[model samples]
Target: MIGQILINGLLNGFVYALVAVGLSLTWGVMDIVNFAHGEFLLWGMYAAFWIWSLVGLDPLISLPIIVVLIFALGVLTYLIVIRRVLKVSGLTALLATFGLSMVLKNLTQFFWTANYKNITNPLVSNKSFKVLGMYIRQDYVVAAVGALLLTMLVMAFMNKTKTGVAIKATSMNKQAAQLMGIDTSRIYAITFGLSGACVGAAAALMASFTPIYPEACALYSTLAFVIVALGGFGNIKGALYAGLIIGVAEALGGYLIGTSYKYLVVFLIYLIVIQIRPRGLFGW
Candidate 1:
């Protein structure tokens, strides 16, 4: 039973890490708190659900399209909203994102309504396979694998590509990057795009099993804030580790205590860790 719980937690941790990574990029690179980040995930899920319902494509089959769409949304967000408030003040940027979040949530509710929607069937069947006396759901396994692959892709992009390097430079010092002809505005747009891409992929992977609704990702958004803080601001690797920890903690807490208090355990651990290392586990 413990082993099974561990497996479930590990799988969930990967997805959580993917979701938090997107928020990490925008926060770490642009120093912009995107209150609308969760809405991006909500939209991605809606996109996947609608495509599956209308076009008869599996979420996995439609994954790439959804990712690209969210990427465009991210770029548009930077250009249309974030860019305007970029220099006004941190508070202004924060407020802008908050307002944007409201707009997005309302738009979704307006078009789709507050009712929950879900994909009845997906390529990955809702079946579990037993291995070494432990059962793992196919959807969970696929989601976990996809999340890991996507996370690695993001890491490689940041480390290997010229644009990635420029992004890193801008994160470290925006003025310096601009002086070096890095085109900080373009980098910012790309960062937001990348952030949205991460969440979009996650949405597609999760759509097989997760319910679709405007508020579906609300809890995820809150947990993401905690994960980002626990992982250390702007540290992708840290976010991965922190996500796993939270996933396991949540599962164990639910089993050992109760589902009602599972999240309490998550927050308690975060509080204790922050007291010891105020900069977070990976923060500099």
Candidate 2:
């Protein structure tokens, strides 16, 4: 039972990490608290759903398209909306994203209604395999693996490439990066796009097993924000580790206490961690 709980928690953590890392990256570079980040995930889910429904493509096979589409949307958002607010007060920026969030959510509802939707015949849906006396859902395993790969790829992109270095430099000190001839605007756009892509990948994986709806992103988004705070805002690596921790905590808490109290346990951990380290587990 313990092992099973651990496995479930760990797998869930990978998905949470995938959701949080994008927010961390955007925060790291632009210092923008994007309230609309979850909408990107929602759109990605719809993209997968429609592609499957209309084109007969599997979510797994359509992942790249979803990523690209979301990336484009992110870049466009930066160019059109976020850029206009860059020079304004932080509160204005926050409100701008908050507005965007509401608009996206409402638009989705207007178009699709509030009905819950799911892939009826996803390739990995409802499949399970037994391992070490525990049955694990195949969709969860696949999503976990996909999330891990995406996280590693993002890490490598930030750590190894020249553009990645420039992004890191920009995040550390935008003025210094500008002095060094890095186009700050371009970097910001790229960061948002990359963030969108990360969320897109997560959405595709999640859509395989989870239901979809106009407001479906709400719970996941709230959890992602919590993960980002617990991990340390602007710290991608921290978010990764924190996500795993939260996942395990939620699983254990749900099993030991009650499913209804799972989030209570998570927030309690967050409160304790913040008291000990105000900047998060790794904010510096």
Candidate 3:
């Protein structure tokens, strides 16, 4: 039972890592807290659902489409909302994102009616297979693997590519980067888009088993905030490790204590860690 729980926790940790990576990018790069991050995830799930429902495409098959669409959404958001407020105070950007979050949630509810829709008979089966004396869900395995691959891809991009280096440069010192001839505005838009892409991929992966609703990503978003903070702002490796720690803690907490108190355990661990290392595990 413990092994199974650990396996489950690890699988979930991978997905959580992906989600936090997205938030980390925007926060680290632009110093902007996107309160609408969860809503962006909600939209991705919706896009997958509508495509499957209307066009008979499986969530897995429609994954690329959903990702690209959400990437566009992120760019549009930066261009339309974030850019205008970039020169303003951080609080103004925060309020703007908060308002945007409200608008997005309401718009989703207005159109989808708060109904919990789901993909039926997805390409990835929802069955569990026994592995090394533990049962593992197939869909979850797929999601976990996808999340891991995507996270690695993001890390590689950051380390290997010219554009990615520019992004990092901008994140480290925007004024310096600007002086070096990097277009800070374009980089910001791209960062936002990349953020959305991460969540969009996560949404696609989760949509197979998760119920699609406006509030579906609510808990995820909240947890992501904790994950990003616990991991330290702008620390991708921190986010990844912190997510795994949270996932394990949540699983063990649920098993040892009660399901109702799982999140309590999560926060308690965060508090303890923060007291020990105020900047987080990987924060400099």
Candidate 4:
């Protein structure tokens, strides 16, 4: 039983890590906390759904397209809406994103009628394998592996590429990066796009098994924020580790204390961690 819970939690954690990494990146690079971040994931889900419905493309097959589309949307958002608030107060940026979130959610509900939808006949649907006396869903495994690979790719991009280095530099000190001849605006746009891509990939994986709805992003978004805070804001590694911890913790808590109190346990941990280490486990 314990092992089964661990496996389930770990798989869920990988997905959470993927979702939170984008939030970490944008926060690190632009110091902007996007309240609309979850909406990006929601849009990604919708994008995958439409592609599958219209073109008969599997979510896995359409993953790249979804990522690219979301990336473009992120860049456009940066150029159009976020750019104006770049120099404004953090509160203003927060409000802007919050408003964007509301707009996206309402628009989704308006068009989709708050309906819950899921992919039918997905490749990984209704498949499971037994391992060490525990049954593991194939969809969960695929999503976990995909999230892991994408997380590594993002880490490599940030650590190995020249553009990634410039992004890191900008995150460290925007004025210094500007003085060094780096175009901060472009970097910001790229970062937002990358973040969107991360969420896009996550959404695609999730759509394979999870039901989609107009407000589907709400819980995931809240959990992403909690993971970011638990891991430390602007820290990718921290987010990854924190995601796993929270995942396992929630699973265990759900099993031990009942599912109703699972999230209560998570929030309690978050509150305790915040009180003890406001900077988070790995926040600098």
TM-score of each: 0.98, 0.97, 0.98, 0.98
Ranking by TM-score: 1, 3, 4, 2
> lDDT value for candidate 4?
0.91
Candidate 1: give the clashing pairs.
none
lDDT of 3 by residue, 1-85 (tens): 9999999999999899899999999987778999999999999999999999999998888889988998999999999999999
Give me candidate 4's TM-score against the actual structure.
0.98
lDDT of 4 at 29: 68
Candidate 3, superposed: residue stretches over 4 Å from native: none
Off by over 4 Å in 4: none
Give Cα distance to truth, residue 136, candidate 1, Å: 0.3
- Which candidate order results from sorting by lDDT in descending order? 1, 3, 4, 2
Clashing pairs in 2: none
- Residue pairs clashing, model 3: none
All candidates' lDDT scores? 0.93, 0.90, 0.92, 0.91
What global local distance difference test value does model 2 have? Answer: 0.90
Per-residue lDDT, model 2, residue 236, is 82
